[model samples]
Every structure is written in C-alpha cells, then in structure tokens.
Target: MMLREVNTQGETKSGEMIAEMIIECIKEAGHENVVQVVTDNASNCVKACALISAKFPTILWTPCVVHTLNLALKNICAPVHNPRSNEDVYDACYWIKSISEDVTWIKNFIMNHGMRLVMFT
Candidate 1:
C-alpha cells in the first residue's frame, strides 16, 4: 500500500521522512508479514534503507533488481572515457545502439499506422 503521495509543493523528501514512511507502511502491513523492503537506488532511498536497518535489524532492505539492471544497461550502452586528442568520443556499444534504434523505429512505425498498431497489439 502507498503510504504517502509526494507532491512538488512540499519540501524536498529527506532520508528521515522516507524512512519514517517506510516504517509506517511496514507497521501497517504487520511487521511480521514484511520480510524485505525493495526500493529504487536513489541516494535518499539508500540512506532510508540504512535507517530502516538500524531500527529493524531483522528486516532486509534491498535495491530494486530492475533498477539495477537498467543502470547496468545504461552504463553499457553509453560509456564515458577520456579522449586523447580533440575528436568526438562515441563509446556506445554499436550492437546495443542498433537494437535500440530498430526498436524505436518499430514503435514509431506501429504508432503511425492505425491498422498496424491494432494488429501488433
């Protein structure tokens, strides 16, 4: 269950607030029923996990695997390196770029054609 809906009008979310919110949710859901907490790999979220671990040592806090996988893919697709000379540096994986472009083109093609989109769906 969602504990709170963060809004743009309020103060920026802090580690403490996030921890408290998670604790509240765990309590509401029955602490015994919750084996672990999965959260995104944001710095605030990681800090919140630390806070949670400090308060409840038995409960495990883990980063979302999907987020971790996406980060890995992003790093592999777009690598950063220092260029030795004054030239453009494109270190992205060619195969990954080609696949991504093909997927994008397919999506655009399907979206542009009503019948093709219906058939694809």
Candidate 2:
C-alpha cells in the first residue's frame, strides 16, 4: 500500500492512482461485511478515504492513531522551533523518544528530579 517513491521503471502513478487502487481492492474482494478502513492522515490517505466512502457508502474510513500522534507532535512543537536553526524539532523529538525508551536513563532522571519530575516538562 506504500505507493510513494519509485524509480523510472513505471512503478507508480500520481497520488490519485493510489486512491483508486484502494477502491479497486475493496470492490475486488466482494465482501459486503466490511466495517472500516483505517489509514494515516496523509493527503493521499484522505483522498483514498473519500474514494472508498463514495464507493462503499456504508463503511467508515478513519485516520490511524499513530498518524494522529505524529501530527499532534508536529503541530505542538513545529511552531516553537526556529526553522532556520540547526536544531530541528524532529531531531529533538527523536532524542526525547530515544531517551524515554531507555529505562536506566529515565530512572536516573526521575531520581534526580524526585517529586519535581511531575512538573519538569
């Protein structure tokens, strides 16, 4: 379903084609009991959702939770960072995520901060 990025071997078409493909797959399946199709909140996914809704008429198409989290993170931090600065928001997010995933580092941080850790952010 990942239709982005391709070589000159005619591997893909425009974004619209991806949308059409989703619809085609649903129709091809011939299943009348489909409930929903969950997708990321990308523009292409939006287009695909629209197409599927128009065709299915009864099925719900919604954004994935992971994509929503990424969008929320971007919206909350993108404006606070300087676009011209070398310190990118994405890098900061990755650093925070990486450190949080490390149990020892998190325990040390929590121990150093004590009760103040709750208000550290």
Candidate 3:
C-alpha cells in the first residue's frame, strides 16, 4: 500500500533525496511495521536502499525482480536503433524475438477490442 505521494517534480533525485523520501514514508508507516523494502536496481535506488538498510537494521532490502527481468528483456525486445547488431543478437536467441512479437500482437489484439479488454479486466 502506498502511504503517501510527495510532489517532488523538479527536485534533483539524488540517492540522498530518494533515501530521505523513503525514510519519511517508513517513519509515517511506523518503522516496526515495515519489514522489507523493495526497489529497482537503479544506482540512486540502490544507494537509497543501502542508506535505509543502514538506518533500519531490521528491514530487509531486496531488488525488484520484475524490474531486473524487464531490464534483461529490454535488450532483446526493445534495443537502440542499431538494426544489424540487434538482428544478430535476435538471430542467436530467435525465440526471444518471436515471443516478444507474439506478446505485442496479443496485447494489441486484446486492447484494440473493447469486449476482449473487458473480459480480461
């Protein structure tokens, strides 16, 4: 559950700033009530989690698995605009490209049709 949303739209999101925001949320939620903190493995987030862990020894810090896997998939499914090198990598792992295309088609098919989208929802 999200405790609160802070409007830090233009603020610099350094590790320290991120840590302070997370710490505030944790304090508001009650430190003892928070057993774990999960965040994506960005440099700032990693540093923030480290700071939070140091401050609250009892709280476990874990990298977000979904975010990690999405990072891995990004290279295969959505690489930079270098077709030759990307095609070479995709050829080596053909199934990855095929599955990604299939998934995109499936998503579009479902989303384009209101009836289909409603069924899933």
Candidate 4:
C-alpha cells in the first residue's frame, strides 16, 4: 500500500526528503515489522535508501526490477545518438520503437484507470 504521494512537480526531491518519507512510513507501520525497503533505481532514491540503511541497519534496500527492465528497454528501443557521434548505434532495431510505444500506452492505460490499476496490482 502507498503511504502518500508527495507533489513533486516543482519541488526538489532530495535524498533527505525521500529518506524522511520512508522513515515516517516505517514509524507508522512499526519499525520491527519493516525488513526491506524497495525503490526505483534513481540517483536520489538510491541515496535515500542508503541513508535509510544507515539509520536502520537491519532493513535491506532493494531496487525495483520492473524499473530496471523499463530503463533497459528504453535504452534499446529508443536509442539516441551520442553527442559526439552522429549515427544511431541501434538504428537497425528502429522497428522495436513502435512496440515500445504500444507497451507504454498499455502501461499508462492501466495506471490511469483506477479499476485496472487495482486489478493489475
């Protein structure tokens, strides 16, 4: 269950804020019940998890596999040229871009629809 969704549109989500949010949730849920904390592998999230691990040495921090796979797929299907290089390294696999777009659409559909999201989770 999600504890809270902070409005981060214009706000800076620093490591301290993220760590505090997780710690707050842990406190509410009872510290002893928390064995692991999982978050997407973003730089700030990684830092936050590190801080959390330091605060609660027993609780393990894990990166979300889905996020990792999504990032991998993004790099493969939407290969951008390097700043110095003018060629697409994966131009031969451009066909995969359409499939990736469709997958993104499906994910957005499920996530946007309350009932579908509930069922998916």
Candidate 5:
C-alpha cells in the first residue's frame, strides 16, 4: 500500500526524522497489519530501521534486495590494488564496467554526431 509522500524541502533527512516518518506511516496504515519495513541500506535508513524496531518490536526492518545487490556488485567490481606494487587488480565483474564504459562512449559518439545518429536510426 502507498504511504505518505514527504516534501522534505525545509526539513532534515536525519535518522530521527526518517524514523518518525516511518512510524507515522505505520500508525496510519494500522500497525497490526505491518509485518516488515523495507528501505535502502543508507546509514540514515539503517538507523531509522533501528529506531523503528525499538518502537515496534514485532515489526521487522529489511533492506531492499536490489540496493543490496547493487552494493555487492559495486564492491566486487571496484578496482583493487596489489599490496606490493601499484598494479591494479580486477575481479570477474570487471567486464561489466568495461562494457558499461564502452556503451557510454558509443552513446556519446552517436549523440554528438548527427550523421551517425541518422544512419543508425
């Protein structure tokens, strides 16, 4: 079910504020029906979950799976360094980064050149 959509223009996006917003939503939606709350793995969001857990002991707070997977992929694909030398080390997911860069370059190339874009279309 859709909950409140905060403006957050002049207000702070702190953990306390986020927790309060979540609690308000749960209360409005009938807390008894709420089994879990899911959010991204941001530090503030994690802290908000902790606060929410304290308020409603029965409710479980979980991180979004897609965000978690994106974090995992980012960590895995990030370039590493050898302890001995300045050489760069890459993992199996490195190819994904390469392909992404190539695609970006191709997109830019096509966008910048009107003739290439016309022919491709």
Candidate 6:
C-alpha cells in the first residue's frame, strides 16, 4: 500500500510506515520466492531499503540501475559554477523520471526508428 503524510491538522501514514509496508510486502511475497526489490533513489526509498535490511535480513533491495545512473549523471552533470542549484537537480530528476516512466515506449520508438534508418540506407 502507498503512504501519505498527514499535516498538523490532518491524518496520514508516514514515510516510515510506508517503508514498513514495503518490508511487509517482501515478507508476504515470501523470503525464498523473492529475489529483489528494485526502486527509485528517493530518500524515503533508501530508508525503506534500510528498514528491509534491518528487519528482513534476507531479501535484497536493489536500487534500480537506471536510478544509479541518474545519480551518477546528476553528480557529473551538475553545474560547475553553481554547485548548490536546486533547478539543475530538479530538471535532471524530471527528465530521468520521465524516461523511466515511459521506458518501454521509448525503447520501442528507438528500435522502430533504427529499423527505418536501416531501410533508408
């Protein structure tokens, strides 16, 4: 189940609870049957993995390869002069999320375009 944070005057589940739910999912999925839990590189996701590691002690929480690459790219592509710029991080994260969100279609389009190029040649 997804998690939602409640405001001071509101009520909702917290990130910690979300992490616990993710661990519960791993448990419900069964220890021997599951191989990995791949997720984004958000802070909450990281915390979730930590919770899994601490509680489960068996299931592997694999950070997505694409997410790792995005992190590496973020560090490398950060503005040289503006080290503390949030805009750069936001733009990079937005594009990365977009690409991952529609990865299957993007791959298909690239393949189709590549075939068309071969036909033209």
Which residue pairs does candidate 2 place in steric collision? none
Q: After superposition, how far is residue 17 of candidate 6 from its true place, in Å?
A: 2.4
lDDT of 5: 0.79
Local distance difference test values of all predictions, in order: 0.75, 0.65, 0.83, 0.83, 0.79, 0.65
Q: Candidate 2 lDDT, tens digit per residue, 1-121? A: 3323324366554447766766666666553856778888778778878877877888798899977975655554554554554446566665545443474476678789768655543
**What is the C-alpha local distance difference test score of candidate 6?**
0.65
Q: What is the lDDT of residue 100 in candidate 3?
A: 72
State the lDDT of candidate 5 residue by residue for 1-121, as single tens digits.
Answer: 6565667998778999999999999999888999999999999999999999999999999899978976655554554533332224354456777665676688789789879646543
Task: List model 6 lDDT by residue over 37-72, tens digit each.
Answer: 777877777787787777767778887898788666
lDDT of model 6 at position 55: 72
Residue 82 deviation, candidate 5, in Å? Answer: 11
In order, how many clashes per candidate? 0, 0, 0, 0, 0, 0
User: Positional deviation of 45 in candidate 6, in angstroms?
Assistant: 1.3
Runs off by more than 4 Å, candidate 5: 80-91, 98-121
Compared with the true structure, what per-residue lDDT tens digits does model 4 show for residues 30-100?
87999999999999999999999998999999999999988867777645533343245567667777888
Model with the higher lDDT, candidate 1 or 3: 3
Candidate 1 lDDT tens digits, 5-110? 5553677778888898889988888888778989999999999999998988888998999789767555555555332322232443546766666866887897
Query: Model 6 — which ten-residue stretch has the worst lDDT?
Result: 1-10
List, residue by residue over 4-76, the lDDT tens digit for candidate 3. Answer: 6677899888889999999999999999999999989999999999999999999998999978876677676
Residue pairs of candidate 6 with colliding backbone atoms? none
Q: Which runs of model 1 end up more than 4 angstroms from their true locations? A: 1-10, 80-93, 98-121
Among these predictions, the greatest TM-score belongs to 4
Please give the RMSD to the true structure for each candidate, in Å: 7.0, 12.8, 5.2, 3.5, 8.5, 11.4
Quote the positional error of residue 121 for candidate 1 in Å.
24
Candidate with more favorable, higher lDDT: 3 or 5: 3
lDDT of model 3 at residue 107? Answer: 75
Worst 10 residues of 3 by lDDT: 78-87
Q: Is candidate 2 or candidate 4 better by TM-score?
A: 4
How do these models rank on TM-score, best leading? 4, 3, 5, 1, 2, 6
